[model samples]
Structures are given as structure tokens and as C-alpha cells.
Target: MEMNSSNLWVFIETNEKGQAHNVGLELLNPGHSLSRAQGDEVVAIVIGQHTEAAVASAEAYGSDRIIIVEGEEYARYSTDAFAYAFHALITKYAPTSILIGATDLGRDLAPRLACRLKTGLTADCTELDFDEESGNIAWTRPAFGGNLMARILCPNHRPQIGTVRPAVFKKPEQDTSHKAEIVREEIHFSIENIRTKLIEEILDADNETIDLEGAEIIVSGGRGVGGPDGFKVIQQLADALGGTVGASRVAVDSGWISSAHQVGQTGKTVRPRIYIACGISGAIQHLAAMSSSDTIIAINTDPEAPIFKIADYGIVGDLFKVIPEFIALIDEQILTMAV
Candidate 1:
């Protein structure tokens, strides 16, 4: 396969419903910058059954070119099928760089594809930029248990591969006025070659559906919450405000909540419209994850808590009392609006 140094491919991972993941579109925001830096074109690769939705989204979001492969075997994600399809595409059109979302399925498929292509892959990249000197993609991620940051460069690799974290970058605004070149490749994977089988899909119980990344408002608690019982108040406030629950590393470590609710450099990074921190002292790692929120409200007993420094509105008091007052005010406002 001949390497094409003029193309940067963004892998758009789609679900069984053919809906493209947000991270794929989010990468396009950075992809355009990378392409501009090296004078390259951004190409979106979509592989799935009934890929009309994904293709339309890629086209709407802005891609210089779109390569699509549709087949029944791709309806549900299997490592073998996806890897085989991606391998075939990469072999046919060797791109300079490949960006994939660091999702559960993506984490499984990227290494396999990278190994087949015999290239280096950087995972959980928080930052990506084009290096002018080496002409390599600079992939940045937290290293050493989130204590430090590492910048990786695959200068020797033909097509640099990386898995970017979700919500690290915002999705670009839709530009229906722009159109991209669409290329549909007919590549079928034999049933025998696909070693994996999809078992019965079991949905997550009610507790596991915390969507902090897509949340408009997040109410978080930390060590000041005391214990699991303290989270009840936090949940009450979040429920009253119709928001999701978030926690610092300490709260997760203490078993007050699930790790899925944890927010920090080591956990998930979030940027919501409004973030309410209750009893949170705000460590640097925690702040780094959510400091980009549009509005931050911090409530703590200590006036000098670090969280107050960045909070848009700071309340130095006990969260237990403050939160109830907030719920009352919201309820009153809703009632007034109804009247």
C-alpha cells in the first residue's frame, strides 16, 4: 500500500442504529486544525450496516472526504469484522494520521488495526496537535497515575494512530452549506473470518446510566460529604435540579458513589452548562477535569477552599443546609412559573 501523506482519516464509529458517536464528530474540530497545519485533507471513515445516518452526520459536520462500508456483518460491532474492514481501507488508501474515539469498542479495535498496519498507537489522548518540525501528530495524555502529562509523537510511523477521549473537544457547528466527496467501498468479511459472536445485549440497570459528559448541569460532592449517607442530599439536589451526579476521586474511593460518577484527570472530564460543587475542596486534578464549565457554583464550609477560587458563585457554609435552600428556591421558581 502506498502511503498518502496528504490525507488525515477520522474513524467515525457508529452503533447498530447507524448513529455516529459524538467523539467522532468532536475529533473533526481538531482534525480541521491538524489538516490546516500540514495542508492535508480531512477524511471521515464510516463502517456499519445502514450507514446513512452516520454518513449524513459526517457530511453535515464537515469532512473533506467520506469513505463508507456497509454490510450485515457490521450491524453489531465485532473486533474481527471492524478490524478487517479498517485494515482493508487503510491498505487501499494509506492516510497520514488516524483519529479514533477512545470508547470501549474503539479501544478494542484500534490496537488490532494498528498492529496489522504495524504502526504505533497512542491511547486516551487529551490533546492533539501537528508538530511542524517533525510533521508528526503530538498526542498528549496524563501519565504516572495522573500526576504528570506526556506528549507522544509517532515520527517514524507512516499513519499516526490515536484514540482521543470523549468530550475533550466540542463538536463543530453543523455546516449544511458545505459538501464532501463520498466514497462507498464494497468490502465484505467472511463469516468464518469473524471469530467473535455477539451475545444477548443486556442493558445497564438504572444505577449505571450516569451521563455526565452530555449533562447540562452536574451536582458534585467530595470528601466533605462525609459518607454514603451524605450523597443522599447530593442526589436530592441533583434530582430537584434535573441534573446528573458527579463526584471527586475521594468520594469514589470512599465508596460513596460509583466510579462512573467520578470526575477528575484520572476519571472522566466534563464540561457542562452549570456545575455545582457541594462540600468539594477542589484538587488540581479535579479542577482540570471540569474548569471549562460555563458556570461553577461551589459550596463548602471553608471560605479558603480551593474550589472557591474558580467558582462563579461561592458560598462558604455547610452544603447540607445550603443545598436544601437551593432546592426550595428552585421549587418556588417552578411554582411561580406555573402560576
Candidate 2:
């Protein structure tokens, strides 16, 4: 492994509009920890046109250095162009490792750069640590149907790389007090070398309707809900509490709900203020996603359900019987508060 700079690099993912994604900032926390132990600086790489907001976010999130790659060709995400720029940077600096958010954009970019640089890339890592003894990163992720966790390593590779899932790690509180050295670099590659072109972008119609990632309270239903109609009860309880509805993989697989609402190892990861699991059996895959939630309430008929073990409060009852009562009690409480 030939090395030059020993700094850790984080890819700050941005949309075509140059809006910074939260996962990029979230990664800085682990990056800070790994860098501290590895005796290296944390570098945030902001790519695309008009990246001032991205740069500011990285600095506020505690990056020690900023590398900005801005070009007209980068205004849109053409894999060929972006990959070329990333490869150029890696060759120039030879950073010890690169961390990318496992976002849609990052999922696309990390592998391309890794292939170009001839290095290993781990995807969807839930945890990252610096092995003090081995002087390498231990990237931990769920494996084998989420029955077990696997910690992976790429000892022989320089610029070790991994893509971490969104919300797998908490976002560090922004400290505007922190600052970073800004390095502006130009992507000298020709746009003609790019094989792909961005023609039109059609945004998701349900983007405004769903926000499980930012939802404060989530009421999740699972296999015990019985059928599609079961979700209505879950929704009613969520509405009563001013929360959003979530679903287990079983519910989604049954075609009872949209995949957007699924929360587990295979779905979107979330850490909410309060999580209510109704009828959920709490598989390890499901627990891996929501275990970090501040408060968990499990309502199920089976006392032996795995969810009860981790729940802050467990209710042994049928969800159909329990939810309506909760809605009624909540409504009564609201009326009492108003009075």
C-alpha cells in the first residue's frame, strides 16, 4: 500500500441543486473518532458546482480540511465526470481512507472511485472504528439475514473505503466555532470523456408526503397487524399522537404498505425521539435499525416477543384492542389540556 497523505477523507454528498445531504454531516462524527485514533486529520471533499453551502456544513461539522471540486460539468451528476474527478484527487493526495454516505448518490459514487483506484469498498456499514492494534478501520455491518454482525477490514489496501447507511450514526451537533483549511481544486478532465449525460430529472411525487427520516415519533406495525386494513389502525394512533406511521419488512413484503415506510436493516434506518412498535415481533434486522431510538414502546400479545426485551415499556395485548384505547385516551388528554 503506497501512501502519501495520511488524512481521512469524507465525501460530502450533494444533489444536482448542490443541496447538502444530512448523511454527509452525520459521517463526520465517526470520521472524527477514527482520525483521532489514527493520528490523521479529517478531510471533507465537496464536489459539484456552487459548493459553498457544502463547504460551510463540513467545517461546522468539524472537518479539519476542505477540498472543493467545482466545475460546470459537475453541476449534474455524470458518473464518468465525477468518477474522474474523484480518481484525480485520490491520486494527487493519496489519503489513507475515504468515507462515503450510503445515499443513492454515494451508493453510485463510492464503487466507481474504488474501482478506479483499485481498492476495496464496504457498503452499508453501521459502525466504523480504528483498530488501534492493527492500525486499520473495522467496518461493522449486519450479515446473513441480519442474524449476525460482521466486522470487515481491507488491510492491504491504501485509502481504505466504506459507505455507511444513513442514520446508522447520529449527526454531530454543529459547532460553528470549528474551522477548516479550504483547498480549491479544478477538475481538469474534459466533459467529452463522460459516457453518461443528465437529460431530465423526475422527482418522486411522494417526497413531500413521507418523511420517516425526520419524523420525531414513529408508530410501526408488523406481521401481527394481519392485513392492509391493519395499517389504518396504526395510522389512526399515529395521527392521534401527531406522529408518522412506519412498517416492518413483513408488512411491506405483504404489499400492505409502501417500501418507503419500511424501517429495518434492509430499509431506511431511523432514530426517532419515540418509537412505538405495535404487533412487531422484533427480528434482529428490525432491532438493528430502531435500537438507537430514544424511547421504544412495544405492544404485542406475545409476552415472549423479542421486541419486549429492548422496549422501555412493554404492553402485553392485541394491537387492535390497544390502539383504539390509546387514541381515545390521547384525545381525552388533549381535550383536558385545552380546558
Please tell me which predicted candidate would have the highest lDDT against the true structure.
1
TM-score of each: 0.87, 0.91
For candidate 2, the 10 contiguous residues with the lowest summed lDDT are: 199-208
Each prediction's total of clashing residue pairs, residues at least 3 apart in sequence or on different chains, is 0, 0
How would you encode candidate 2's per-residue C-alpha lDDT over 227-248 as one tens digit per residue? 8999999999999888999999
Supply candidate 1's per-residue lDDT for 143: 70
Which candidate gets the maximum TM-score versus the true structure?
A: 2
Cα lDDT of model 1 by residue, 164-224, tens digit:
8888899999998889998889999986678977668766464448889889999999999
Deviation in Å, model 1, residue 291 alpha carbon: 3.6
Backbone collision tally, model 1 = 0
